[model samples]
Target: MQQGSGSLVELLLSADNFYELVSTIQYLDVIQSRNSEAVSELVSLTDELALTQASLNAQMDEAEAEKQRADEARDEAEEARDQLEAKIAAQAAAEAAARKAAIEAAQRAAELAAQSEQQTPTFTTESGNDATVEVPDLPDPDIVVPDSDKDAFVSEWSARIDAYLAGSPLAGQGTTFAEAAWEYGCDPRLSPAISTVESSTGRVCFLPHNAWGWGSSSWSSWEEAIWAHVAGLAAGYGGQLTYAGAQKYCPPNADAWYASVLANMLSI
Candidate 1:
């Protein structure tokens, strides 16, 4: 029925209908054009949004990579710091141990020196001549036979002592003692002197194995004494000792004790 009514109105209003139809056609055309433009703008905006999203994703990836790199660097730095700290700790420990050992050695030496006055020092020489001597004792007659008459004394005593030790026991019996004395590479006359001076004229040295004044308890045997003696002489006289710069072992006075000790060796 509504369609029939619209048909009757169309037939009755011809001129009015033409004008209305033209206006409606013009409005529809404008509306359709505006709608098309809006659709195109929307599509363009969507493309731009997609591009922006892609760019944001790339930036996020780069930022994540940078963060990962920074974290790795921090971890490496921490590891390096830890290693340095460990090395420092180890060095400190080693220094402490060295200091402790030095302290212990010094203490032992002090104790030994204090307790060894009453007892005599004793040890066998490399030449196989064994005689007990007192610490800081009177001079032996054999050693007292002056250096000027040293040759004759050496010849006479060497022959006698060699015979006694090697089974002769006669002064002019044979020259075996002289040969043994010579074999020891040190003077036989000086040997008695060394013993007497250190062991106290057959009384006591009481220091463990320091009979010939050759060692200070750190040395163990006669061989060590011999080597130490030889080395000491060369080094002491030739300015080879580390402490004695530009001068040999001979120094004046008891104040320079290390040097004085070096000089006294010749007397022994």
Candidate 2:
């Protein structure tokens, strides 16, 4: 019919539409084929869309699982950091306490030492004698006497000298001479023997009880002369009986003086 105007069913029914019917039927067949191809393409597209949706769901599940694991790991790390910080805080507190204690102990020790230096300590002896001796600052004594007073063998020699001087001016004075000789550390017989040679056993003298003929020597008493002569003999002539000592005592008549002194000593 007219180019493309009427329906195919209406064109088929007309006497002038014979060619139109043929053309229309052919067009209908072609349209039916295109519809079948469109339907097949639509089915393929629907199947691909379903498969993509499943894959997206699976990726979402995997992402959710990874996020959960990351959260758990973050929680564990936080717990470890908290425990470490707690330990550090505890150690710092303990160290601070120790330093404070050490400083306090040092301060106490310094105080005790200062107190001890200021105080004078009292010393106690073991014998239970509690006499508090107040020792004053005094000058030293001039002489220190010995605790013991001994005879020095003077008593026996004094008795012998007394027996020899029976009736002389120096009677009963033998012990005095012996004491003086003991003090001077000389032979007790040396003085009496020298007296016999110089003054005939002290019966005669130049002056004032000078029994020995010592040069310008005198005394207020026989006791004084005895001490002076014995001290001189010890200091000058020495303690031993020798020819040299005899010469030193009597240089002018050493031989006669020595002989006479020795003879008198033998008699005693």
Candidate 3:
């Protein structure tokens, strides 16, 4: 009976062990199921993190591209501005240089005029009397226009004078000479003919603006010299063209001078 009881207890313990083993196996299965769910969740989270990282990287690259474009645009704008400023500065400098050159030219012209004014000539009357002829302060050339009588005289003689002086330095002064002759009651052809004889129509002169070789004279401008010489001729030579006048004017070569002057007057 004791052996039978021991056998029954061993069977009961074995059955309990079998029940515990079954319970432990079911717990392990539950743990495995939970672990599988957790692993799926972790894998899903890792995939989501990788996607987020990829999106961040793409955004960063786009932002970098935008910054580079903005930088390039800024550089282009700066370059354009610099080129525009340089052009403006160059134009201003050129204008300033032109103004400086004009001022220098005007100053030089004034200096030459002042130098000429320092040397002038004295005149002699037909009666062999020495005289200091004062130049009339004539009106400016811009303001002076010939009247009807002077205009007629200029029209008649201007073309002739221009033709005679075409290749000479005294070219283009026909109207000035004609107008001065009319104003001073001198022969229009007398002064120009004398210029041809003495100074080769102002191609050469012993003094500044002394085209007629009247004396040791210098004038600031040709207009002033023309008027002064005409006035002197009217004062001393009776404003006429004559052999007597030529003899009194240049006794050393009166015949040749008079003949040349007559021929020039006839040609005119």
Candidate 4:
């Protein structure tokens, strides 16, 4: 009976061991299932990370391209600005040079006039006799003469003179002639009319600036010549247009010269 009881106990212990083994096997199965799920999750996370990294790389490339374009635009703008500034500088330099040249020309004209004034001039009469004349102190050509009728005379005769002298070498010399005539108390039309007869309004002259065919005189400028001629008329011809004056002016062809000069004067 005791042996039988020991056999039964052994069987019970074996049964318990079998039950424990079965439980351990169930736990191991659960652990394996959990491990499989974790590995799958890791793979999914790796794929997502790769996709995000690619997107970031694409954005960075686009940003770099944009920056390069901006830089190129800025460089082009600067180049254009530099070119514009160069053009402006060149224009300013040219204007300054032109102004300087004009000033120099005016100075040269003044100097020549002063030199001519220092020398005594000779006038040839109708009889071909040379007469020495003292030059009077003349007013500055740059300054306007203060006479009541000066403006009216200049306004009327200058326009007429300019109209007649249009397309000629002496085109712009109307104001000079008018002013000189008013200053020296000479007939405004006399010298210009004589010029039309003698030198075709200064187109053909025997000497420089001697449009009136006056005494082989050469002048540096038209202004000086106009002033001197008007002054000479005032001193010699009594500053009037007369038959006797015309006879004295051109003894060789007095009648024709007088008629031509009168016709021109009337036209002006």
Each model's C-alpha lDDT?
0.42, 0.63, 0.65, 0.67
Candidate 2, residues 61-110, lDDT tens digits: the string is 99999999999999999999999999989875754453344334334444
Model 2 misplaced stretches (Cα beyond 4 Å)? 1-152
TM-score of 1: 0.36
Q: Would you estimate the TM-scores of all the predictions?
A: 0.36, 0.43, 0.44, 0.45
Across 63-143, the per-residue lDDT of candidate 4 in tens digits comes to 999999999999999999999999989865764454344334434444665688854333343324332222212111111
Give the root-mean-square deviation of each candidate in angstroms.
21.4, 44.2, 23.7, 20.9
- Screening candidate 3 with a backbone cut-off below 3 angstroms (N, C-alpha, C), the clashing residue pairs are none
lDDT digits (tens) for residues 1-268 of candidate 3: 1124354345344444666656655755897899999999999999999999999999999999999999999999999999999998987576445434433433444455568884333333322332222221211111123356766778877777778878887888888888887787777777787776676677677688887767667898888888888888889986766545666776754444544455455555
Off by over 4 Å in 1: 1-18, 115-268
Question: Which one wins on lDDT?
Answer: 4
lDDT of 1 at 38: 95
| After superposition, candidate 3 runs with Cα above 4 Å error | 1-148
After superposition, the stretches of candidate 4 with alpha carbons farther than 4 Å from their true spots are: 1-147
Candidates by TM-score, descending order? 4, 3, 2, 1
lDDT of 1 by residue, 1-268 (tens): 1123354346334335667666655655787799999999999999999999999999999999999999999999999999999999987676445434433433444456569754332233322333332221111111221245546755775554444324211223224323334443334333333333344322344444344444454355433443454344334433121223212221221112222222232333
Lowest summed lDDT across 10 adjacent residues in model 1 is found at: 134-143
* Better candidate by TM-score, 2 or 4: 4
Tally clashing residue pairs in candidate 2. 0
